[model samples]
Target: MEFGILSLIPPIIMLVLVLLTRQVLLSLGAGIVVGAFMLNSFDIVPSFNEIWKSFSQIFYVEGDLQLGSIQLLSFLILLGITTAFMTASGGSSAFGEWAIQRIRTRKGAQTMPGILGLIIFIDDYFNSLAVGQVARPLTDRYKVSRAKLAYIIDSTSAPITVVSPISSWGAYIIGLIGTIIAAQEITGYGELEAFLRMIPMNFYVFGSIFLVFLTIYRKFDIGAMRKHEEKAQNTGELVDPSKEVPGDLNNEFKATQGGKIYHLIIPILVLIVATVTTMFITGIQGTPAEEEVSILSIFANTNVNRSLFFGGLFAALSGLVLYMFLQGSKSSTGKVVLEGIKAMLPAIYILVLAWMIGTIIGSMGTGEYLADRVKEANISPTFLPFMMFIVAGFMAFATGTSWGTFGIMLPIAGEIAATLDVAMFLPSLAAVLAGSVFGDHCSPISDTTILSSTGAGSNHIDHVMTQLPYALIGALAASVGYVIFGFTTSTILSLVVTLVIVLVVVLLFQPKQNSIEK
Candidate 1:
């Protein structure tokens, strides 16, 4: 059963097919079939049965209809319909027109998503989907390529969540740190302090954030991104004409003349408020009455899927009400609503396929095989963080799940550091966190990456190909910083040097371009 390196075949096959074919669903389906067959000893009937079970399990697990996947899908549907209402009512165009007057430049349009991505760090899912809806109009107006917008969204989502203790990601990571400390039983610091300490050592977090703005301000693109940006800026075509784009409703509904700016603002604000409020209520209700209720405890226990679903529901309702009020009862309210729902289908399809592939990869012991290889290697104490960064990066990229990588690698990193050198423990864990984000950013099948493209209305493959260069440089810089921290144990020195390296690399890789319009 321990397939070791053989388990790498399905994921590698998936990546190659995706890169060559540029068909996400087909690539994901092929990977799932291969992985399922491997899990079932390559038997024809059992392999297909396994695939069916995986697909069905998305709706029900443990003999109960699970809300986790269903709620997420509902939320996506609601988001789409809400946008449809906004478009039919002319709110989206009104807001874009309003923003264009004040924002003025392409840099200003690009700045909004990055800033919004940082501010909306409570959950990467909400941040990835919502920020794109809010900023896409402006970015399009300024001729910023959807690929670039997606890069910014992808950059800020997980990187910010992993670093912020107030976020869903932070709660999960802190809990893992607690387990690692208790399991190792040689801790001088508590979970919260260790989480704070690792923030600076998480060099990729800052490096990626800085690189996002650095690219925007410096006006440079790398690899395929240059072509996308130039095409957008020159011809005002925000997306690649040849490819399919998710969350693109531009051609579905036109903005009406009667719509007001507040129409767009109201639903978005409602969504944010409703989602946050639900998170608190659910988080509190889930905790036992006998236990203390605190911020971290609340976030740790919060039902993100349920909260996001309700939030989307309220937002959609608000948009619907606005449409009825502005467009009157005679207007085809159902049509606009349907268009919005239809707009999200492409993203939903891709998301569901990505989740299925993730499940099969899990069943095939892909992560375990990679982890076992890392365990067998006799890596030195000083190289612990460096090796962990590399291994975690690969694990996450192959599996397309950073959180999964964290679950598998954190405890292992703790044990390795515990045996090798206690001083390297936090650095090793930090490297795992940084490396996971870096790999996830690059992965074509990553959920956050897919949501980012959905949010940005970019072609999924275009986003993946464009973001790869920056992810590599960010990981390289973080790796260098981990090496330095392992040697000197100086957070300040390591962080400063890592950021400098990112800036230098960003500047050095300036794209060669034809005359792009200002």
Candidate 2:
């Protein structure tokens, strides 16, 4: 089987299996197996021989494995270990208990997660997992729906990351922007410099973040999420198990303490500070020192991962120390940390599988084939960005992985932008990032989606099902914004108009009330 037709086979098989059985893991596994079988179909004996070869090539240092696969696996494992360690130390639970003490009203309960999500914009991965973990209990305490919590977490993750100039996402986007400019033969425009110039024009990123804040602070509800919220309020049902903490209602206030809140706040603050400092020192945007000391050189010299690994390690350690010092052994800090790690096991497993599947897809040359087909289509320059956005969205959704989407889209988008003279550079780059985020936000297979559910203690399917409508609203808004920016003279106006329309729709429809009941 040629790779092109073989590529279609996995998704088709996955779709049929998923629809017939509704088992996500089984579907994903079948897709992986199909991809592997396709790769080995040329020769049974040689293919079986190559299976171990392929696996080792992808997993180990040798072979023709994709570097992105290795980076993703390393990051996921580190993330899992860090998350497990943090929870094991009791920091996550302590934060939740602390937040619950202050959230008395229903509105406050609902808004708190949004606020936390906004503040944790240092990294999307951090923001998605940490906010979900800390806010779930508080949201549950006030009878807030699990779907709502997942929505807040997912909405905040990619949107905030896109806007934050200091994040890992920022660095990646800036690099892509540079590639677009260079490919287009644009002179005198540095990568970071070009990105900064386009910041004002990156309306979707900023607008999405602003819309999230509005949704929370203004109590705006839309689509299915509104329906869920209303049902929870009417029935007083706990939609999420993580929301159910042990102990009686009358004694809830008595269980609260001022010091518990500080434990949560301080560690988060440390992580943020560390992230910023690391980026700055590394000169992610090419510091003046880059003339003599390259960012890559600095990273290689300092063993940066070790620093982040230890930084997270110390943050967990400090949280435990505080727990013991303040609670005087009543806190069971060690037990708390242990439980947190145990809690994250399921998410970790899912992420590992996702990475493996992504690796197989990459190894099979899917991205190159897709890019070649796209190039042959000869799309118009004016429609390029909009089309790219749609294509990227579909690819990410199909793969259930945004980073993988970027890995495939960035090079193609850069090449396309280059071919279109210089006029389409910024718009093209924006489309790729926006599309990747759109799929990640909506896809049930995404790591962020799984993590959000894990953090909220909600069923993964329920989170995916409930969050889809709201995500689509944002995607529609973004799509319109992309079209206007891509093809028209009034890019900023298009963005503003699109955002305003989406906000109005959300406020008016208010889906939380209706969706939750179903």
Candidate 3:
């Protein structure tokens, strides 16, 4: 049952195919088949069942459609329609025209998405989708490549959420930490305190965030990102003409005349407010009567899938009503809705395949096998954190899921540290957290990366290719910090040094400058 090293082949094959073919759907499908074969020991009939059951489980449970997948898909369709409605009503165009007067520089335009990503930390999915709606027009007007916008959106979304205890990711991690500590019977600090302690120790989070701001304010791009930036600036093309970009509906719908900035602003505001309120409500409802309701309790218990669905519904309806109020039946109601749904099909297709591959990868035990090997590593306790960071990064890179990495590696790291040296516990776990983000940040199959591409209207592969060098730079700096942490358990020293490394690299090594003026 334990395939060991063989578990790695499917994801690796998938990654290779995606890079070469630039075909995500086919690559993901191939991964599913390969993993299925491995899971079934190459028995053809059983392998086919493996593939069918993996997909069937997503939509069917006990003869009824599964609520979780249904809710998520509904949200995507609604969000797509909401985006379409904004365009059809001319709200998007109006806001762009309005912003051109105030925002005079490219950096100024690019800065807004990062700032918005920081503000919208409630959920990464929301942040990825909403930030694009707000920032895309501005960034496009300034000729910032869609790939660049995606990197900015992605770098901030997970890194911010993973660190902020109020966000969904923090809530999940805190719950896991509490469970691990309780099971281990080692408790000097509670879950909240433990999470707070790890925040500063998360070196990659800060390194990646700094890189994003530095790239925007200081003007730098590495690897293929430079080509993307140069092309965008020189030709006014935000995306590669040859590559397919989702969520970009060009000339498919006309912008209504007499559009106002408020038209664009209100629907998104409603969505954010609605989603947050639902999270709180679901959190409260899920809590026990005896338990005292608190901030931590709210987020930990909140139903994220349900919240997104309701939020998307409310936002889409608001957009529709507003469009009708303005256009007064100028465009057929069905036509606008259809266009919006059409724009989001590419996103939905990519998402479903990504989910399937993730499921298949989980079954193949790719992450678990890697974790087991790392668990068996015969290394000094001082290097435990560094080894964990590297292994966790590779596992996530291969499997395309940081949350899965956390589930598999955190307890193992906790157990290892508990057995070897209790002092290494936080450092090891923090390294896993940081490394998971770094891997997820660089992965082509990562959901956050995919949504970022959809949101920014970039070719998915371009976003992955452009962001890899920056992610590696941050990972290298973070690895050094983990090594230093191992030798000396000084969070301040390690974190500051990691950030300084990023600063020096950016300030000293400028990739050949593009023609964009300061």
Candidate 4:
């Protein structure tokens, strides 16, 4: 069935369906079916049989399904449970109350979300969900628009993850870089060291993060959502800021003050500590087996399953224990855990669907085909980073999945850089990561985008509508940065320059409108 031509069909059909229906899961599922059909194009009945085979391949390979579905499920479950616990323990509420008390100025309130986004850069999924979950109540308390919240959360998630060395992303990226080096039969450079070297060249990541901070500090608005933001500010009405919030609206303030601040903070701290301790014990730092362990290996190893889930679980447990000890009631602890899990349910469903679609795309060969085509184009060695960014952005935007984009582009980009004799591997890898993140940041159909909207409790369309302009601002800055690093100067210098430009531009162009009422 000419696999090349056949490969294009699924993505094309998926795109058409998505644009027409605006239903992500439906589009992805249809795409997967089409791909499977194409694989069995020679036989009608067999095509149907192949569809089941493909589905099973993704879900039941060697009885493991790679646990990809389960991991996503666990993440969602843990998110819900932890959120419930945090609320019940008064953690989320306490943080909000504290933020309200401390941030007296409007600009300060606007900037707070971005700041929090930066602090949680360890992983994109964690950053997306946690920042939104923790900051929504506070942002709402200050009458910040849900669109603004989504913008901040989405902006920070991918960019921060790309730059942070200790994140789930970092592990995947490092492994990929290592594989590329080994595949090309290159020697003399250690995997981690090579990655570290490339960080300076990863202009997009630094630029994006800079733009997010700039958006917050400068209050820039340039697109459809700008009107919404302005209207919200002028009317002083609470607009539905995020998609996660339900329509019931029985009480505006029920979840706002349900838990305490200490409950949230202590649990988060415990998670961090546990992650560090586990990393060291697991020897993720390329250290000797008998040597003293560094606190960084927990996430570096490939064997660790559900690390984020465990981290979330531990945090939730800590919150529960603290709640029980402080409130002195087992029933209270149970209620908190249950409620948190419930709050996280919607997000869980969305993530599961998103992951399934991503898995389907991989199984169908859509991602690989696209990657090979980009590679065949033979972009110039010097302009490779910028080109990689564009390719990644398109793939992620088209598919609405950053991780899938990375899975496709990273290997290709790495191999290209190796072919070009480029010594700095990290920056090239960082370019792929940055590009994937940029597209995901802006795409309405992206899972992270959905999760951010959910976490902010804003309307999904509203969040996408508002966040696009701001994301573009970051993307533009990042593109320029990528160009600089790829063609002209040092990566570190490019990062600094890009950051400055974005920050200034965003600050200079504040949105005209300021508030809205629900």
Q: Per-residue lDDT for 308-380 in model 2, tens only? A: 4444555555555665575433334444554544444555555656655666666676655666777778788
Per-residue lDDT for 439-491 in model 4, tens only?
A: 88766558778777766766666676677666677678878887777666586
Q: In model 4, where is the ten-residue run with the lowest total lDDT?
A: 246-255
Question: In candidate 3, residue 68 scores what lDDT?
Answer: 77
TM-score of each: 0.98, 0.79, 0.97, 0.81
Clash count of each predicted structure: 0, 21, 0, 36
lDDT values, one for every candidate: 0.90, 0.62, 0.88, 0.66
Ranking by lDDT: 1, 3, 4, 2
lDDT of 3 by residue, 218-292 (tens): 787877988888888888888877767878876586788867887789889989989999999999998788888
TM-score order of candidates, top first: 1, 3, 4, 2
Candidate 3 global TM-score: 0.97
| Model 1 spans with C-alpha error above 4 angstroms | 328-331, 512-517
Which parts of model 3 are misplaced by more than 4 Å?
328-330
lDDT of 3 at 23: 87
After superposing candidate 2 on the true structure, give the runs of residues whose Cα lies further than 4 Å from its correct spot. 15-22, 42-59, 63-104, 200-207, 210-259, 269-308, 323-337, 511-518
